[model samples]
Target: MNMKRLLTVVLAVVLSTAFVIAQEKTVDGPVITFESDSKDFGDIKQGDKVENVFKFENTGKAPLIISNVAATCGCTVPSWPKEPIAPGKKAEIKVSFNSAGKMGKQNSVVRIYSNASEPIEKVSLISNVLPK
Candidate 1:
């Protein structure tokens, strides 16, 4: 009877440990929430440089790490935070579009690479360049 009780206790402890491990593994990482993903510069003169700031927050359990920020074209430049954004903290991505050679309805894309729930997030910049 004592041997059976010991085996049962051991099995219960093992099962409890496995359940805890599974729960921890199921926990998710960081989540990124953006205030606005698209920005419109409206009507702008040619050769004018327009800029916009995209704000975001990390709303998850773990820290947010941004690996890279890239623009679709050279005319569009993006700058993002270098360090990790702690959970519940905010960050901004600065995007600039030079309308020097671009004309008409211009649309630019910026891609953000991160360890958030969504690995890649894209933002857009739009503008209408008027003649100088």
Candidate 2:
């Protein structure tokens, strides 16, 4: 009887831990989506700056938290909301591409980290550069 009780206790503890781990989030209750998965600036000249906004909705039950936003290239700048996104609310990510010292087929990627199931999300920007 003692062994049975002990086994049951251990099983309970293990199951609880697994549940918590599975629910671990980088982005809180929010979902990150964009108007488009990618954006094309068409033809841009060197030294020009362009920007785009990514729109998303908080589709989860809890408030979504966006921890950080980063761009793969130094020439690309990205910004995201720092505060919690309440359920059924909306959020946006603003990205800027600086054409300084860059040319040809330029590609940039932005990653967003949140307390979400899939905490890391990616977006991309692409364009062809024209000479000044």
Best by TM-score: 1
State the RMSD for candidate 1. 7.8
Estimate the TM-score of every prediction: 0.78, 0.74
Candidate 1 at residue 60, lDDT?
Answer: 84
CA lDDT of every candidate: 0.93, 0.85
Candidate 1: lDDT over CA atoms?
0.93
Per-residue alpha-carbon lDDT of candidate 1 for residues 1-132, written as tens digits (9 for 90 to 100): 999999999999999999998888343799889999999989999999999999999988899999999999999999999999999999999999999987899999999999988899999999999999
> After superposing candidate 2, which stretches have Cα over 4 Å from the reference?
1-29
Query: What range of 10 consecutive residues in model 2 has the weakest lDDT sum?
Result: 26-35
Q: What value does the lDDT take at residue 96 in candidate 1?
A: 96
Clash pairs, candidate 1, are: none
Candidate 1 residue 36 C-alpha distance from true site, Å? 0.6
Per-residue alpha-carbon lDDT of model 2 for 1-132, expressed as tens digits?
A: 999999999999999999999998655455655567678989999899998888888777788898888889899999888889888888889999998888899889998888866699888888888899
Clash totals for all models, in order?
Answer: 0, 11
